[model samples]
Target chain A: MKIAHHAHKDIVIPNSTRHLVTVRQAVFDVIQESGFPEHEMLRIALAIDEALSNIMEHAFETENLKAELTINLSLDADEEKFEALILDSGKEFDPGEIESPDILTHVASGQKTGLGIFLMRQVMNEVKYTFVSGFRNELRMIKYAHDFKTKGATNAGTQDHYQNH
Target chain B: MPELKITTKIIDHDITLIRLVGFLDAHTFEELDVVINDLFEKNIHKIVADLSALEYISSAGAGVFIGALAAAQENSGNIILAAANENIHEVFDLLGLTQIFTMTDSVETAAKAFECNA
Candidate 1:
């Protein structure tokens, strides 16, 4: 079974951070529709949020910002898998080169930026970055429930979720 | 974007405590560097970061920590993480930083780790 959904909204102040819940819910709905648990859906949602945050920040300049963020969500019922594509007409960026901060070191003192992309690489089964015409940026991420490569204790189908600790 | 909010505390004469909250992803990751650099001028060599309120982080954000660690180390200072959730620990474990840096379950323990070890 294949579940597909697409959401397009203009760049508005509310959409920046506040709308993360809405965007995440739309994807979670797809996970539920696909017969997956909440934990699986959240992993997908958080990944989407990270991708969209990058697009909104990198694609649109802070001064003349108002770009559209398009998210395509697809799930394979037979495979028990989820995939999302984040498309933005923002500036060009490649997260691959960004090195992950040494958490041990940061734990002792300060924080860093490139850690976001690194964490995505670890949790998601596949993450790809591409640019079309140096104007549009695309981030495609995919994960399979059966793979069980990346996980948190509160994954889909699990009852306990540490919403806050 | 991970929001890297910085708060400070006085730990002994040389150590400074930094509290991080919200998501510290790609968007606000760089700010961590700027904040720490400014703190360097204040002679904060030993640092303890409270990630209790932090919800999310990515590799790029991880890079910030590494850079700050190097910077602080050069000045004979150190960075320690305190009270990280399982998800955050997973990140550190994957990167093999668990062995290199000190991690504790709580802020108090984290501070003691740095004061005793680093």
Candidate 2:
């Protein structure tokens, strides 16, 4: 089970909102090079941005340690998959414990929290979180290249791929 | 500085039309929040967000609307979405905002909703 990739890039930046554009541009460049459609490319970038925001909001809370966040972008040629891996040196948190926002109820009540995780789970084909040793966390977001192809598969009816832990 | 431009147009003293161009994410969303808050302060409750040129929006951008819409509803107004691209629509749909928002094909039609209600 080997999936060959065509393009790959690794980026590291400080844990700050200002660096979101840097990460988004890198993911956009890689996704563009992978020949993914422009619209889907933007969506992927948005998902990656949300993940980065989550790291800044929760993981880096309580203290602004001089830390760095790593983002890895890769496209599998054989499987036509695009994946982004975000690693952070922030507090350990459980992604499974986050519930999907009752969007309707929440919207009716004016709550903005919880939509970041929901967007990550909804936009990307797959999203996973892992807690590495000692205050390290990795969030993975994946999208199928074919899903954005002009004549490729429609995203409708695709099974949810977000996993716990 | 985020690469986003927001232009606001006040119509009829009750409706505020905002045009969003470029991307909306955590960094750039504050610009939107500021404009919406200013509108609320002025007692302008109804809003129409023109997203025809909006290239991207993260969840935080969408969250801005959640708060704006709720406030509008409380003030007997509404936030109408107009000309959203498929990508923007997908995010809105994923969050089930379609049911919560009144989406129209054009700003003309969205503006008419306010007229009809009035």
In order of appearance, the predictions have TM-scores of 0.65, 0.84
| Lowest summed lDDT window (length 10), candidate 1 chain A | A156-165
Candidate 2 residue lDDT tens string, B20-103: 998888878889999999989999889999999998788888889888887898899989999999888888887788988999
Candidate 1 lDDT over B14-104, as tens digits, reads: 7777888876655566677677777887878788888787776655556677767877787887788888887777666756677866777
True contacts kept of each: 0.48, 0.92
lDDT of 1 at B26: 52
Number of clashing residue pairs, candidate 2: 0
Docking class of 2: medium
Evaluated against the true structure, the overall lDDT of model 1 is 0.62
| Per-residue C-alpha lDDT of model 2 across residues A1-165, encoded as one tens digit per residue | 333336677776676777788787887777666555555766677778888888787776556453454334333312377777777767876565677767778987888667887777667766667786685676766777565552332465222333324
Chain A TM-score vs. truth, each candidate: 0.69, 0.76
Interface DockQ of each model: 0.24, 0.73
Instruction: Give the whole-model CA lDDT for all candidates, comma-separated.
Output: 0.62, 0.75
Indicate which candidate wins on TM-score.
2
